[model samples]
Target chain A: MQLKRWLNNYVRIWGVYDMAYDESEGEGVWIYCEQEKGEIHPVSYELLNKGRELADDLNTHLTALFLTPDGSDAQELVYRGADRIYLLEHDNFNYPNEIPFRENIVKLVEDNKPEILLIGATHFGRSLAPRVAGALETGLTADCTGLKIEKGDFVQIRPAFTGNILAHISTDRCPKMSTVRYKEFDESERDTGREGEIIDIEPLEYDGPDVKILNEMIIEDINIQEAEIVVSGGKGLKDSQDFEIIEELCSTLGGTVGSSRPLVDEGWISRNHQVGYSGNRVKPNLYIACGISGAPQHLAGMKESKIIVAINTDPSAPIFDYADYGIIGDLYEVVPKLIKELREG
Target chain B: MANFSIIVPIKEVPDIEKVNFDREKGRIDRSSATSEPNPFDLNALEEAVKIKEEIGGNITVISMGPPQAEDTLRDAIARGGDKAILLTDKGFAGSDTWATSYTLATAIKKLGHYDLIICGEKTVDGDTGQVGPEIAEVLDIPHVSYVNKTIERGKDSIIVQTEVWGRLYKKELKFPGLITVTKDLNEPRLPTLTNKLKAKSAEIERWGLDDLLDTGDEKHFGIKGSPTSVVNIEVPKEKGRKSKIFEGKDAAKKMVEQLRKDLGGI
Candidate 1:
């Protein structure tokens, strides 16, 4: 006992003690605010809304780590919920490069030591978060659907085994981190009356192999996740050309076109139009499933929508189990008729 | 142009589509399902093989799993890999992305020389596209994710097309870099009969924690090295909704009316 006590004292004096779970060390909650072309990703605002609540639970301040080329307005982040902003402006931040971004973010986290770090699980966030976590040697949960503070522990909830199981995860290390999925939570209301502080962080010089962006192909922004109405198709379509009827119905309803994984895999539609566990998770106000048998993976993506209407010929289809309304009919006949009815009405 | 040495990391995952769920038991019966190479990892290996064909090079396939994962490595060898290595040990089980990446990076470092590494966008069972970038970070190399097409291969650099969000970017990265490929990269080829026969008798190098760890610290491996743990796992409760069925001729009209009512006149 005496030797163990002496060894503990020696380790503490030599600063070799394991600093894994020191509750007094880490402070504040941080959200990495991702921006593209001077516009912040909507998911960042959503995280800010959720981060604010988590910070309130921990009785700690909320900080937004904003790294942008043009130094886009940080005040909006403040109005949304962040108590402070860590602004890092550099021309290199224009494109999504993981190296420098990871370096700077890791340095900031090491310096400030935020207790909880949240990032949106976009393509960039998915790439950057892991690098940052690897550098810090900390744990990171990916594509979390829910996050909460329980008994002073930050708990991350995510789907495992292709959305069949939901796992509640916790990190033993400080700076508990998670990459939350988009559209999982609502954004906090912006209050112009709110005031906050913005601290400027000096950008670090990086000399690694640089990734140069030669050209950017402009693709139409298909923001299906933010759509109010979504009309999705599935294998029930006789041919790829049958998507025209689904498109007509979607156009008539002024909604977006979505498809099950098979249709997307068959090249009938683009991946952005896919709604499933592997594709986009959409929480639109109204979701219309045409000929979709509703596999568990597909249901996991869109079941959270306000209302779901399933159209299929088989009454025994699993879609009916989760659909708010079920229509037993051929989509080819039903979709065209629905379009005509909407046109006439 | 010099020949490139490419490394591809693949994973064996339970066939998620075929896995059965016991609703009463509130658990997934993964044992009933067969295991297969992660679909996207095949795309990564296909890209690596394509690169080897275009430019004279060697391909090394690596994986971390149980002893049975040797089958996955042999399959990769049959597919086009010139060599295969399996990093399997009892100490490497239950590793999160961080520990898994660290272990893979250590193995890659011990392998000596490589110009490029390729990985799938994500695993099917884990569904976390994290290990690739984490590996690159541990190695202090540049990485690009969601790469759909390889544009050009130069002496010391390569250009590729990647997608972020909804935009397509043409990016150029130096050698000794990593890329996580998407399904759009290319269709994987089936193993040839001759190659399959050759792979049946091929020797695969098996490495354990003792081989990779120089510090003799087992804490950097397996569940002990992992910082994250699943506290609880539960089958997601079905959010049952009102299943109002409409049939006959007015089904479409009824759906439209109900949608209009719920959405306050669409």
Candidate 2:
């Protein structure tokens, strides 16, 4: 295959930033655009939209770093606000692997010298961001919910101390980077009138590390982040086994099942299915809260849903404030009835 | 026999449940909160201890927190750490992950050689799982994040299982690499009486920026080196749910009808 051929004859620039580089200023807000299998994640567009504001504030270009195969879409990025696209096309680099991807992206960062770099804090970005930050020897803020340009610096705001406090971080270093959480901001409005340039990167002869990918199933596991409708439970569920009812409701409604931190702490559900400020910031079409008292932390995670329906026996439960519809009844009774209706529908 | 040089970089975070926000000050009132060794770091230490048990190795636990963090260091010792290093420098007060990683990496270089570095997946305080990989980069090594297990460790390479976006991947990396441990790595071993006694006498090494790094470069250690600043603090407003309460027999069906009318079909 073409990937096999390129892997053998690639070029390697090991530790390009190992030596100290002068504090030279660069102008541009760069977004690390990522894709899975081939589908471009919506977060990239959201970041591009966010980066455009920063680029405009800095009077610099808005660049999208597309490290994918050549077949990936380039038009959507420009319409979404990217002014320039740096395409690192390689057949071997279909999936975002941290090691080799870092080797390549770091090379580009060293060459281009972006002023501010924004990456979506998805599975791929989280793994890839540190390597780039490490190589560039610059500061990075992880899981940022807010990004703004104030007096010429990119200020990264994120909930710290596990949602107890927000820490505002700035990077005096070049290419101030932040891994932004998805669904925290609205996607940039698309416009076909926008235009951008796409530059192809030359082939790199770097081979994958000694570690081999034994089996990459790429299973489409359902989680809160990707769910259209989410059925969530809280401490009121009492026993972990009751989560099966939640699963049944979610499945019947054609969505994903989610839980609060206590459920996850009790090992009732995997961390992926957790919903809270520390967990996924989900923006599903419909969010069903069952027996959730709606702590401030939990509220931050799911309150942004388009429509919320809270089922709690307690009249004073906090979840009802953010919820569009509140059902004051026992979840065991309310949930099974809702499930039966959903199944019938 | 391959004895591993395993280093786990951990943090002592404020007890979040007790933390409160001061609306007047526009900042969190962290003074009243207790401190706990970040749980993720404990998981990393557990993974390190397990590797030590399976093979043969010395585990050096490291942290860059207030001197009060010595309690956390002792806890690490009580678990499985053979030695502990507390990088406490007044210069590191406001250091971000970048500066923190640089300081930790410089200290690691001073310690001579190491085969592996493990970090908790993320701290409950900062919640940024960046330091481990950042340190690897500063030290010019590869790293794996979200690691749940160390499947195998041969002479020159290690095999690990990492969860990425709800999918699991088994990775192999050469020595001198780093891996951040997830909370699921293993239930951390609680300190025993014997280990606690051993920990009590264990001398935790303390290093300031001047000891292991060039104290002159303000950009390498603390707030001077930190580029980001917390310009604003916003405490999310607590808006209670709808005050309406419908009770008795038909409440479930009635709620469903209202939900369907207002929220639309699922």
Candidate 3:
């Protein structure tokens, strides 16, 4: 106990974590406000609300780390939930390039010494957090779905081995970090009138190292993450010829078209269009399962939808148990008619 | 010098099926679970092996798990690992990804001389996919993730393709960097009888915390080295869907009508 106390005092004296670690007593919790082309990502807001809860529990403030090319997100970040905002603007930061982003974020955490750092487990964050954690010599839990305070420290809970199991993990050192998966937590309330501070930090000139983006191959598809309604087809669609029904219905419904993993395997759809344990986890208001047998793996992704409607030839399909609505019939006959009727109505 | 010097990090995760969450206790039950090499890591190893095949090179595989995890190392040997190092210690328990990365990074620095490090985007069990970049960060190397294809390769630099939704980023990175490959990159090769025989006799190197951390601060090694903690874990509670069943030809119209009403005709 004496040695532990000594180390605790040493951590504070050394201020190695920038006030982040005084052992059990934390400085604050910070959330990275992620942006794409100027628009803030939804996950950032979700994290802010969640981070606020954590900070409040610890009697600490919640700060926002906004690295952007412009001040577009700076104002909104304050109105959301952050008590303080660290806004860094730079040309390289316009895109969440791993190199400059890592360098800057690591410095921010080190200088500010927030005891906890939360990032969205989006493509960019996944790449950036590990690099930051590595540079800071701190622990970062990735893709966490649950976070809470235990004995004055934050505990992160995340899915392990894909969607199979949940692991409760902790970072014993200061600046405990975690990258939260999208849709893991509901977006919290935002009050535009909520006042907060925005500290503008000069962006250090960053010439990125070794890696460079040479070119890009673009394919337009629905942004499944932001979609409110998703219509998914499975192997029962048989082939692309039958998949047309799903597409047409999706278009008529003004929603995105998603598919089960089997359809991707059968070469009927691209991997991005897949929604399952191995694919996208969609939390749309309504998820329509057409000719899909609700495999547990498939359910792992979309079972969180607000309303599930399953259409299958088998009435005994496990999907019915989870679906708010069920239709027993072949998808081919049902989809075209549904599209035609919806188009008319 | 070898054409290419590489390291692949592997993990032995509990079987996906055998994993169960105890909501009441806020824990997972894996006692009945058999362990297997994290499938994603195999993809990384496979990609590294293919690169080595294209040009003559040596590959060193590393892992930090229990003693049983050594079996995963031998399997990597079967796949194409020329050297295997295992880091295991009682203090390493519940190290989380950061500590795990630290322990692994320490081992890598100790082994020295590596042109590249390949990792699965994530492990089946850890599912964090943070270690590869973390190691690169600790080593101060650049990293790119979600590469589905490698377009070009050479001794000093390489180009790869990242296929995310709506766009595929063709990126170039100089050597002595790290990459986390996805399954879409390539199909892994099955171990041949000869490689299996070789793996059976190949010796495995084991390192404990004492061997890795020069600072010798036990607190900076495993559970102690970690910063956060797991407060609780439970299976996500899924609300029951609306109980409305529709059937026959009229089902389509009726469902659409109901949806239009519920969705405010979006």
lDDT (Cα, tens digit) per residue for candidate 3, span B86-199: 998897887766677777877888887888899998876656778888778767788889888898877787799885323678888888888999877887889999999999
Task: Please tell me what DockQ candidate 2 reaches.
Answer: 0.48
The CA lDDT of each predicted structure is 0.88, 0.79, 0.80
Tens digits of per-residue lDDT for model 3 on A1-345? 597567667875664552244445448989988887556888999999899899899998999988887876687877788989988887776554688877778777756777888999988888888888777667778788888987765778877544545667866666888899887787878689889999989876776656887876555656786788899998787668777788888887778989998778677887778897767889999899998898866888898888788989898888998998888888888788887887788
Give the best candidate by lDDT: 1
Please give the distance, in angstroms, between residue A188's alpha carbon in candidate 2 and its true position after superposition. 3.4
How close is every model to the real structure, measured as TM-score?
Answer: 0.95, 0.90, 0.88
Expressed as tens digits, the lDDT of each residue in A1-345 for candidate 2 is 586345423421332233223335566789988776556888898898888888888898999988776545977888899988887777656644677677777778767777788989986788789878877767688989888977776788887654545667766567788999887777899999989898878746677653466555554666668788999989889898899889898887788998888888889888878898667778898898898998877886888787788888887777888887777878898889877766665
* Candidate 2 TM-score over all chains jointly: 0.90
Lowest lDDT sum, 10 consecutive residues, model 3 chain B, at B231-240
Question: 1 or 3, which is superior by DockQ?
Answer: 1
- Per-candidate iRMSD: 1.4, 2.7, 2.9
Clashes of each: 0, 16, 13
- Model 1: chain A TM-score against the true structure: 0.91
Cα shift from native, residue B22, model 1 (Å): 2.6
Query: Best to worst by DockQ, what's the order?
Result: 1, 3, 2
Q: Residue pairs in steric clash, candidate 1?
A: none
Better of 2 and 3 by TM-score: 2
In candidate 1 chain A, where is summed lDDT lowest over 10 consecutive residues? A15-24
